[model samples]
Target chain A: MTDALQTDPRLLVLAQGDNIAVLKATIKAGEDILIAGNEVHVGSTLGLGHKLAVVAIQGGDDVVKYGFPIGFAVADIPLGAHVHVHNLASRYTTVEIME
Target chain B: MPEMMAWPRQDGRKGIRNVVLVAYLVECAHHVCKQIARPFDESDVQVIGFSGCFPSEYGQDMMTALCTHPNVGAVQLVSLGCENFKKSQLAESVRASGRPVNVVTIQEAGGTAAAVEAGRAWVAQTRAELQNLPMVAMQPSELVIGTICGGSDATSGITGNPAAGVAFDRLVSEGATCIFEETGELIGCEHVMAERAATDALRPAIVDTVAKAARYYADMGYGSFSNGNATGGLSTIEEKSLGAYAKSGQSQICGILRPAQRPATGGLYLLDVVPDGPPKHGFPNINDNAEIIELISCGAHAVIFVTGRGSVVGSAISPVLKVCANPETFTHMSGDMDVNAGRILDGGGQLHDVGTEIYEKLVALGAGARTASEALGHVEFVLTYKSQSPSNPACYPN
Candidate 1:
């Protein structure tokens, strides 16, 4: 990570209870980030406005954001891994209507 | 504070702008209505329509509410003569409001061109009548304010909506009636909002409305069912909701209102946009402007529209104050945006500052400032079918 990353904010932490942080810019794999006094390596291509796992999430665990539950992780999401639909599923299920 | 002047209506309501509206009763009359409004070449002359031919209770209610909108000084209804839009009901309500209304049926008026010419003369005459009505000074207690977030992105949660929330706080504190809607977008926020309810009875309705919004979205999902989750910011409904809920500020939700229903008095109110009974079989809001139109129907003189992805929509009667949440998007679409709440993310300012900016912009708008969309001639209005539950006293216990 460059020294510029220390002075400038690249990731946003919305709430203290949120378990994820959003990237302000697109991040490439192997890039280093400093957040919440911890230095972590980016594990995948994290797109802008996309969520990053700030903490470990076991399978079926809730993915917390903005101090509330956004969804559940479908897989064991490692810290620094990309958090998206591939690993997360909506907590609310769709209701089917008969024609 | 500068004293704001506004168009005075018969029902003790004030309008931020004096707009002569040409309403198309159905899709067929839309073009003729547009032509009728074209020659005026003025922002105050606007066209709005309900595209559906089959009459809907909610649609009729919206048309009546819109015709009686405080900003609308007069109305010209363009009817195809075959559709069941109930022009008589609309005309009666508009006339009762003491506003001059002209109904031109294409079948009776020879054709489209003849109807347009007739509408033009009626519009000119109505303009003269509107000039005679008294213009009064608007006070905070007399103002009806509304806020909505559109095309929200990641930055919206921390910046745009929260700033709007702060502005809402100031408005509510100033004794101005404030409203925020889109219960569907507030899936995860029912509990928090209900807890802030002024009346204990309104709490359950708040929760129930959120549930209805969720069910409606769930039932109306696309075949692939990726409803804006692809936006790369929001992963689930709750995440997007948390962002949406921020727009209410910290004001106690004094009451709840159905679509097109005005508040009984001035305070913080929640507009429940979810279909009340059996589903309406159509989208709750066809677009952002539909919600804006509903706010206008509720007598909102000015609308503060916060957008992160940059929506350029503005309403016909009421002026919209566009507050951009994403700085990058603001930089890209600055021409469409009025205030840059994105400055918080760009490190130029804070949420409270953006809130103050929004509050000032709204005051200026009410004082006759032309928004970017209004200056550029973007009067995007839409109304679709939606049903509501039986009205409850709890919805408006003043």
Candidate 2:
């Protein structure tokens, strides 16, 4: 099992082989991060429960949740960038963002 | 696989109980039906009715479905002489399903007193024969279960809903029929849900149903997603919908059913609670109990209800298993809850552990064990008039 309590202060992977890890606490840019056994610099700050991709994702790439595709990335999301409604759009029904 | 028990009916369907049903055809016949059902004094012989005077194809269809439901072994129809609800047709449908059925009219029998006496005798005889029916092995695949969440708070989305989602995933994998409803609660997440459809054809229906719900609630001068929702810390309807959608687990969306429409196959099916067009008879469902009635009409054997603020209500025909998600609410209202998914939030248990507990409880209930609601004799049921066009041809095979 992946360590539930990892050395990283911000995020933890819930399941092994998962492409994304959940932020355990708010993370800031330029922080040292360990994801999928690799050390990388945080690209951006992210809130708790928000997702951070272990690898870089390009525009129109599918975002998986619960190991299934929930939506697609609307723009290129760097590794450790906060992944949520802002960067992702549902592939099924139109979601109009309120300005 | 472990062997499961069931009440085998003559019609080839199996049930956990062999119930004798007393049905009221209209509002006027309700009292007589209740009085007649009283003599049986057993949960297996329960009274269920529709209180409408006008003719409704929907009402007729639901009545037939309930009267011949797998759990029902026989039926008695109560009618007032002047109502448009056709007592003969209703009784005929039940009889044709291979169940014994009879009808008694207050006007013909002289009054309520006489009709009640006649109805009581008929019920007694039917109950005797129904008790003798053979028990058979019921597989998990034959079970039809429904789920709904009410009295929701922030904790609902985080714990209880996802826990139920875990149970839904297990049940669907076993080939059990699972249904989750309330499109109004699912306003913002429709696009995400539509993507899970089993086919490309069902995608539009998914969008249309959510659109229909949005328009219906908008016309009422309120968002189907409520302000109380915001107070509960749910920022938008879409966010609330993401939580509500969690109840379906990670299964493929099999099909869509309107109120009382049974699914063609077992899996995760969505029940569209919104009316087809404009609101006709007030709100789609007055409250949670009304939603429960729709679940029963769709042939659910039981319901798994998730709540955060606390809900003490339970349904009549089917058993209700209450799951409490908030640690504080669970502490305050422990008596009302059957499972404490909130334990996970308290760091006392894991989500998978609580989910496994719920799944085992469902299996026991499906094997003739009575839930707290069923033991309390809370067999609350109701049917109201609403219109629906037949399902689209592309949605089902002919």
lDDT top scorer: 1
Alpha-carbon runs more than 4 Å astray in model 2: A1-3, A6-99
Predicted candidate 2 versus true structure: per-residue lDDT over B1-398, tens digit per residue: 34668777666667766788888888899999889988665576788888999898888888887887877788888898899987788888787888899889899999999999999998888888877777888887888888999988766766788889889889899998899988877876777788889888888888898888878877876555455544443333455577777788878888888776777778888888777878776677778988987887788877899998898777766778989977788899887788898777566677788778788888787665677666666777766777754766565322
For model 2, what is the C-alpha lDDT against the true structure? Answer: 0.76
Give the C-alpha miss distance for residue B51 in model 1, angstroms: 3.5
Q: Which lDDT tens digits does candidate 1 get at residues B266-309?
A: 88998877776555557878789889988887878888898888
RMSD of each: 4.3, 5.1
